[model samples]
Target: MNVSIPTLEQFREESRAGRLAGRVRLQLPCNLTDFPAEIFSLADSLEILDLSGNALSRLPDRLPELRKLKILFCSDNHFTELPRVLGQCKNLSMIGFRNNRITHIAPEALPPLLRWLILTGNQLSALPSELGHRPYLQKLMVAGNRLQALPQELSLCKNLELLRIAANRFDVLPEVLFKLPRLSWLSYSGNPFCSHNEQTALADTPVKQIPWSSLSLQQKLGEGASGVIYQAVWQSVTPIPVAVKLFKGELTSDGLPISEMAACMRAGIHPNLIKVLGKIGDHPEGVNGLVMSLVDASYRNLAGPPSFASCTRDVYDDDLRLSFSEMLSIVSGIAGVAQQVHANGIMHGDLYAHNILLGQNGDALLGDFGAACFKPTAAAHSHALEKIEVRAFGYLLEELLERYEGEATAGATFATLTHLTALRDACLHIDPTQRPVFTEVVARIRTA
Candidate 1:
């Protein structure tokens, strides 16, 4: 049956006739100007309505009246603002708008009933405060936007489960995002601040225990070549929630399974790295697990590199300064950390903005260690570490400089450039053998 969905009105008329009740899926023109108002009133059993792949500008004004509408797909459009009519739909659970021209959203735009909201690939510079007021928001996918900062109101979301805020224009991510009690999954991949693989592991990963009354969870934080992380709480301690990482793929690159994961648990310690507090033996229910200190924060999806959707010119950060001195400070802070990794004989494979996590006290922690691999005893690992580290650091410096001096030039600042340019160039050198050692680069940065 070629159920031709002519205009929205025709679709509604057919829908009102009841034959289109369970089989109603409409594809509107890319230049569609509005939506069918009568279809919702008659289709008491309507469940899914996909209005994507269109040139629509705004959501239908009468959507709230559709008490039975469940899922709405409104991606690929020219909507500059969030439709106020959306706030009226109390039964609506999911809404998607991945590719659109939306720039700003009013604070109270979404109804408190929304559970899922997808706004990736949009022009939003920031989220509205009303987004947090939603009592049941479960998954928030705002990965590719102009967002430079997250609204402080997100902490109020008691039921937020998964959030992905990857590939954006943020240099620093706020720590408050971790305060939410129900949040468990997050990825913040491409910001300049990430470094350690977003999740850490141990020979034994501890799962924090929480009381049933406290909205606790038993979840898999995810696994890696290093280990698997789980969320749990202490049974005896009551409501003490934490993440437990159990080491796996233990065989070192040398081909011998690492016993050091256990040895290091006994010997190692660091504020930045997860602590290994010994093993809990094998679980009666299944595999062995470990106990460790739980860090206070949630996951952020902020990875990959700068894409076309990465920059947001209209999205401004008040702290932004184009001065070389300021740029130097930023570089200095990052370089200072690189110096430490070099000391520990550890090289951060992915040292970009997204991996960098700024602490509440104004310090930075390199998050996301997915590409972080142990340098083997082989010559290839040692011979090339210097250049690899330099390239990563240099790349970060370049991004900062470009962002700071948007449309401006390094002209007349030759003195400053002259001082750090050699080091920068050395870091960016194609031939790893030509780059300066980490210590040497640090000395030059301080001297400059």
Candidate 2:
């Protein structure tokens, strides 16, 4: 309602002097100067308070005075860590500290009643072990961080229903996570381990052994605009894992013979992509279903909030992040595999994170050639499209690394940005005559 500091201060002073307001929602102007510490004066009646977007560094010393506070919004601040006194706010329910420099989340720093904790777009490499100890933390958003792995302690939170840990450096997810019986919904895209391609396998890929009737289908993993993924599994399986994806849909094209979708999937084979272990031919339950490798995971959309601590309220399960090096390694590997794909004259039109697979070893595979158009003269066309694809790689790299100027290295957060940008700018020079070929990218990655 357009409140100035003076107005808010008057309430705080009056309240401390013993007055009351039903509830309070303060919106600190994004560029405001001094923070109104007086807001904490109402220790008894205040239930919900928002002090987002101000130049405040440390929280007000008297914040514990807001004994009645339930939800707090102290996002977009300069705090390195949350104040320990906040734990005293026994009535707190939800809190957001997005877009800050917070790198640590101690065990006892939070209230027991917290259910929604959002912390996206921060410098968190791994979640603190203490964080898993939260009693009522039902929803957690720790998306875009430098995490290399997940903690086993997370399974201890029996009430945790949804987990969003996308855009981290994880290659092998903790197997213990699936033990949480209440964990029904999860999104772990952008992780180096969650493979993107769930179709086709290299020559001689192992056929997955399955006891069909024992498996119960929970729900379908919508494979986005490219393919279809599923969440079905055999009963009594430890960790209750599910099949990651399946193929066998739409078979006809303009004026083309009806080979049937099942025939089309069974024809191709690649080691990196999901292998169709077995097929249930034309069953009444579904059409020509092909059994594929199980990822024990699900796909998530990247159109929601950042997964950092501050992004709690602003983000959803869909919002995920992708780092530069991870993206580059993924793209480079995909390009290498595409060399094999080009042998067959195919192009994976949608070559983004949504279509790439991060294998258990952090290797990436190209998949989802749905939009692919056949190029009979693919060998000649590769020359023209190689640089074009490289430029696309650069754009994706920018999104992966949040910076525009830095090499992709262990310390460089924005690794591919500066490296690829320089090459792309040269390749896409106004005088098309100046672009470097795809060989440069291969050479760079090899040396890096």
Candidate 3:
């Protein structure tokens, strides 16, 4: 799955042999200060173009020459604004400008068919109303900005499913957002909706804090927007093995690391969750961290992250198919975990196939509390927020059905899949009040 990136020399050789003209992908990092005119020759067939890790300031006016280009990545660039020329790319749908100095976006800068847009880690205070008119805009990442409010027009994007607006200056989430038909995945932590009391709760909670000096760090297991996770040995009296997450402590696209730590501790341990052992204490650099039980090696991610074309949905392999029994078990396990976490006054904000780890016989564990938020157990909107998460669960269930092979066989497995699909549709209703709560979802799946 690792595609080697062609170097400048390799591209030059290919260009000389007339090979570049027919190629579908062109990726290079040549520290460009201006657009590469050489790419225009391949305009007839080019589909994906990656010029990331460059010093480019602006795109050329003739960028529309690449009529077939659909995906463009300009991340880690020096652009002060998103190039308006991008709108001219008639076929361009997915555009990424992450980690740029971009502060301005022209009204017509977006392509007409944009489905996925990544503008993370930028300096934008506002977005153009024209953006809301893109009917196909499904995935949007505007985290790490200084925005005070979202354009109500964005609610008009009925197909929008995944949205990241964390670490912004918003005092309240727009009411229009809650009514979007397909807004299943969302992150609004670090906004004013996140309670100030949650910060005090973490400090006042009576959880055990383990000293950092007592642990020996080993190989890194994984990493995310907030922190790096490592396989470490807790040098206790018995020298036990454990997983340690060292938080960067910076405001991430999801929220603050401290908030994630507090939410994880408050979630408490459940059979289908990653068990938190304690908090890391007395680090030399004073970094916030958490110690948790190491997950077994037999577990692996259920699916890959969303692709450019899928927008908000996770991508599964063509051969990845699950049986009726396995599908039911995984769904029930996750629903049970969500129900428990909600009862403890926490919402796992980022629930997706990528966050789930599957073991032998479909045992599932839901991890990654980076996007989790603390909710008042009796708040009026608490029920609505939980229902929003249920819609996310419906999306997950629908993906499972898409990969299920039982429908064609037409038997008990097919019947069961059909019933579950009905439940998923009910959960995904546009009206939040109509969707079943996690407890109800669990009970229905269990009875089946």
Candidate 4:
């Protein structure tokens, strides 16, 4: 669905005629060189203000005048620093400054109520220690930066659940991250600590190489931040249909595209994973891609991506409800797949409902390697990494349980719920060492 953005002239006219008053959301992507003074008129009702794709370098000192603003996006701009006045907006909870030239953040730049913050594709060498002061922060994206370390105080953010520190200068994993109690989703693939001869890991994976001439591209099936997936026909003797994922060869909020492709190549085949058939060779545009078995048409995403309000959790359909049996099957399939993936020494970093597809009977296929990373060779590091992902699975299970419409107080259904709840608790243990391994989780779920 295309959302029509108001043109600069239209917005100016609306502001001049008092037509924008009481508007809760406003998006103006025109090549703006200045923060529109007219926006101040909507201070009474504006909650979302998107000024992305503009040429602005600074915000007015009175930005806090928009007392009701809750979300602000100024990506694709030229700002060198985060406006300190943003801290004065008591209600501002989400801020995105992606793809900006920002190199510094003032100590008072962050809002007190910040829950979601995006600084992807910035030039910052370090982050403000004051970041740890935002108790409400839950999701943070600081990929594609130059930072070598994180503030030790960040461990104080107990509610932080999802974090992306990929493509940075970290020589080792920050010890502070392990202290985050609710960190369920994490991606740190392209840093120096993990990037040493990473390609050699795929040397033993005997995946076939499928040339571009052997495939016929049809229509785009989907597109994510890293690549475009197409429904294509493999022009072999049998002309079988397949899904082709072509990488965009750029840094994403999660990590680099080459990292994702490498992870997918190393994932290999599994019943619950989208089967990777071969690596695309000799593309006309020299693009890197993967050919995978096409999923059945009946399969659909289990849930939608996180919303502005949900921040780190997936959002489900309002009418969606699952019975105990269906929920069990889905969770069981995912757990089984996760067991196999971790055994192969890969972490499905972005393990969430949005990354899962479900069939009518509740069979699940886990897709998307955009946030995946290989485990470090060290036994201790690998174990801790896997445990972090275990928490992500726990959250997924919790979400499904919340949507379960089964008989909670009855016989079999109640027993099943009790069993699953215990499994979720085990996975969500605050101490990574206490969380059950995927092997144990799979075994427990099977017995349940």
Model 3 steric clash total:
0
Q: On residues 1-448, what C-alpha lDDT tens digit does candidate 3 reach at each position? A: 2122446666667677776667788787877777757788888988999999988898999999999999999999998999999988889999999989999999778999898888988999998888889999988888788888888898889888878887778776567667677887777666666656467558866678898889999999999978999999998878999999999987676677877888888887788999888898798998989999999999999988877667777887778888777788899999999999888777788899989999987799998888887764556667877888899999889888777656545676666677788999988898878999999999888766
Candidate 4 least-lDDT 10 residues: 1-10
* Candidate 1 deviant stretches above 4 angstroms: 1-18, 22-31, 41-43, 195-448
Compose the digit string of candidate 1's lDDT tens values, residues 246-349.
55633221111122233233223444445554455544444444555565565332234432123201222445444565566656766876666545444454
**lDDT leader:** 4
Candidate lDDT (C-alpha), each: 0.57, 0.51, 0.84, 0.89
True-vs-predicted CA distance for residue 390, candidate 1, Å: 32
384 Cα displacement, candidate 1 (Å): 31
Question: How much lDDT does candidate 4 score?
Answer: 0.89
Candidate No. with top TM-score? 4
2-100, model 4: which lDDT tens digit per residue? 122557787888788876667888899888999888889988988999999999899998998998999999999999998888999999999999999
lDDT of 2 by residue, 36-68 (tens): 555555565666666667656666556767777
List RMSD in Å for every model shown. 18.3, 20.3, 2.7, 1.7
